[model samples]
Each structure stands twice: as structure tokens, then as C-alpha cells.
Target: MENHNHTALISKLLTCVAACENCATECLKEEDVKMMAGCIALDRDCADICSQAARLLQRNSVIAHQYLLLCEEICRLCAAECSKHQHQHCQDCAKACMECAEACHAHHEPITQD
Candidate 1:
């Protein structure tokens, strides 16, 4: 029985997952895909982390905040990689990653049980 209001976090996580996946695929399509091997790898890793984080949050895991922190790190890494590329896809992915990062940061705030 999860709170309906928290669905927004799930949605943002899903968006991050999709963006990272798409960025990896797009990187592979580039003419110099070999040069972006690291970026592609990071994108895949980020996507996986985002998915797992979302799953943990959806399940209301007590330690979900840790996963969200991981997701933020991965998204930042992916965004930095994508920002290095000049392709349109990379630009779009960077924007998405940035948004996801911000959302994760906002959602991970500590709740005081006063």
C-alpha cells in the first residue's frame, strides 16, 4: 500500500531509465562509437541503477534512499558523458539525465518523524 503521491518519483525514475537506455543505444549508433565505449558502458550502468532504484522505492524498501543516491551518481556520470558528445541524441539524453538527477535529489530528502 504505497502512497499515491509518491508515484511522481517512480515516474521520474522510469524516465531516467529510459533516457539512459536510449543514450547508450544512440552512442552505439555514432560513427565513432568506439571512442564512446566508456560513455556507452556508463549509460547502461546508469539505466540499470535507475530501474533498480525505482523498484526499491515502489516496494517501499527501508533503504531505498541509498539506491536513490546511487541513481543520482549514475545519472550525473551519464550526463557528463553525454554532454561530451555533440549529437542531438546525446544532448537530449543529457537534459533528461539532469532532470532525473534533480528529481532524485528532491525525493531523497530526510523526513523527520517528530
Candidate 2:
């Protein structure tokens, strides 16, 4: 991938990571924490995957492309879950996840085995 592309994708991934983390933290503070369990779990999973994807992209790892595919999937799932909530943090996280998913989809490249 090109340097500029990598930078942009990494930025999106990191942004998604922050959004996911924040959403999870905020969800825990909601009055009905049990009701937000699914959202919280997806948020944490999305954050972890996005963080890893960003790191792999930063180092130009050969597996980054493949890993991004997984990241995109997780982002979409997270977005869907977040969109179901009315909280401001959840809405923000949904937007971030959707953007990150789009970025990952746009940047996807065929993986070549060494």
C-alpha cells in the first residue's frame, strides 16, 4: 500500500478504536448495564481489532490486508450494535465504526503469499 493510503487507513482505525473504547466505557455507566452488554462486548472487540489493524498497517506487515478484512467485519458488527442505542457515545461510535469499515473496504488488496 502507498504511504498516504496507509496513513489514512491507520488514522481511521485509530479513531474507531477510540470511539469503541469510549462507547464501551460509557455504556457501563448506563442505568441498565445488563441491557448494554451486547454493545459493550462488541465495542471492546472492535477496539481490539482496530488497534491491531492500525499497528500492522503502521509496520507495513504483509498480513495487514488480510487482517483488515477481519477489522472491517468487526467494525460493521460494532456499528450495527451501536446504532441500536440512543446514547450520544453509541451514536458517535456507530459513525466512527462505519467510517472505519468503509476505509477498510476501500483499501482492501489481494493478499499474496510469499
Candidate 3:
């Protein structure tokens, strides 16, 4: 990836991580927390993947591309789940997830084995 794309991808990944964290906290504050089981689950998963992807990308690891793909997949799933909720946090998270997924798709390339 070029320097510009790398920077953009990192920015998107950080946004995904921030969104996931906020979503999880918001879910915990829901009056009907049980109703947010799916959202909470996805939030946790997305957070983990986004965090890992960001770390790998920061290191410029070759495996970062693969992690980016995984992050995109997880973000998409999380976004779909969040879209079902009416909470403001969920809406914001869904938007962030969509943005992250787009960035990931835009920069993702197949990893080549050395």
C-alpha cells in the first residue's frame, strides 16, 4: 500500500475500534440490556478484531492485509447487527462499521507468501 492509503486505513481502523468501544458501553447502559445480546457480542468481536488489525498495520506486518480482511468481515457483521437497534450509539457504530468496511475493501489485497 502507498503511504496515503496506509494512513487512511489506519485512521479507519482506529475509528472502528473507537466505535466498538462506545457501542459496548452504550449496550451495557441499555435498560433492556438483554435485548442487546447480539449487539454486545458483535461489539466485543469487532473491537478485538479492529484492535488487532490496527496493531498489525502499525507494525507494517505482511499479515496486516489478512487481518484487514477479517476486520472488514467482522465490521460488516457488527454493522448489520447494530442496524437493528434504535439507540444513538448503535446508529453511530453502524456508520463507523460501514466506513471501516469500505476502507478495508478499498485497500485490501491478497497476501503473498514469502
Candidate 4:
């Protein structure tokens, strides 16, 4: 991958991590925490995957592309869950996840062996 493409995708992945963490924190503060359980769970999962994907890509790991596929899937799921809520944080998270997923998809390529 080109340096520019790596930078762009890594930036999006980091942005997604921040958004997911913030959304999860804010959701916990909501009065009906029980109702936001799904959102919170997804947010955590998305954040973890995004962070891992970023790290793998940063080091140019052989499996990074494969890992990104998983990241994209989790981001889409998180976006869907966040979109179901009316909170501003949820909306922001949804937008970030969608963007990250798009970047991941655009950058995805056939896995190469070492």
C-alpha cells in the first residue's frame, strides 16, 4: 500500500476508536443504561477491533488486510446499533463508524503472504 493510503486509513481507524469509546462512555451516563446495553457492547467491540486494526496496519503486518475485514464488519454493526439511538453521541459514533467502514472497504486487498 502507498504511504498516503496507509496514513488515511490509519487516521480513520483512530477516529473510529475515539468515537466508539466516547459513545460507550456517554451511553453509560444515560438514565436508561439497560436500554443502551446493545449500543455499549457494540461500541466496545468496535473500539477494540479498530484499535487492533490500526496497530496491525501501522506495522505492516501480513494479516492486516484480513484483520481489517473483521474491523469493517464490527464497525458496520456498531454504526447500525448507534443509529438506532437518538443521542448526539450515538449519532456521531454512527457517522464515524460508517466512515471508518468505508475506508476499510476501500483499502481492503487480497492478503499477501510474507
Candidate 4 lDDT score relative to the true structure: 0.93
lDDT of 1 by residue, 1-114 (tens): 244365888888888788878888888888887998988898889889888888888778866775677788788988998899888877888888888888888777453344
Ranking, lDDT, top scorer first: 2, 4, 3, 1
Residue 74 displacement in candidate 4 (angstroms): 0.3
**Using Cα atoms with residue i matched to residue i, what is each candidate's TM-score against the true structure?**
0.87, 0.92, 0.90, 0.92
Whichever of 1 and 4 has more lDDT, that candidate is 4
The runs of at least 3 residues in candidate 1 whose Cα sits more than 4 Å from the true structure, single-residue gaps closed, are 1-4, 109-114
lDDT of 3 at 24: 94
Query: What are the runs in model 2 whose C-alpha is more than 4 Å off?
Result: 1-5, 110-114
Query: On residues 42-92, what C-alpha lDDT tens digit does candidate 4 reach at each position?
Result: 999999999999998888876788788889899999999999999999999
Question: Which structure among the candidates has the greatest lDDT?
Answer: 2
Candidate 4 has its poorest 10 consecutive residues by lDDT at 1-10
| Candidate 3, residue 51: how far the Cα is off, in Å | 1.1
Better of 2 and 3 by TM-score: 2
**Which structure is stronger by TM-score: 1 or 3?**
3
**What's the CA RMSD for each of the models?**
3.3, 1.7, 1.9, 2.1
Query: Per-residue CA lDDT of candidate 2, range 12-105, in tens?
Result: 9999999999999999999999999999999999999999999988888778888888999999999999999999999999999999999999
Cα lDDT of model 3 by residue, 54-112, tens digit: 88888787688877788889999999999998899999999999999998887677766
- True-structure RMSD for candidate 4: 2.1
What's the lDDT for all of these models? 0.81, 0.93, 0.87, 0.93
The C-alpha stretches of model 4 lying farther than 4 A from their native spots are 1-5, 110-114
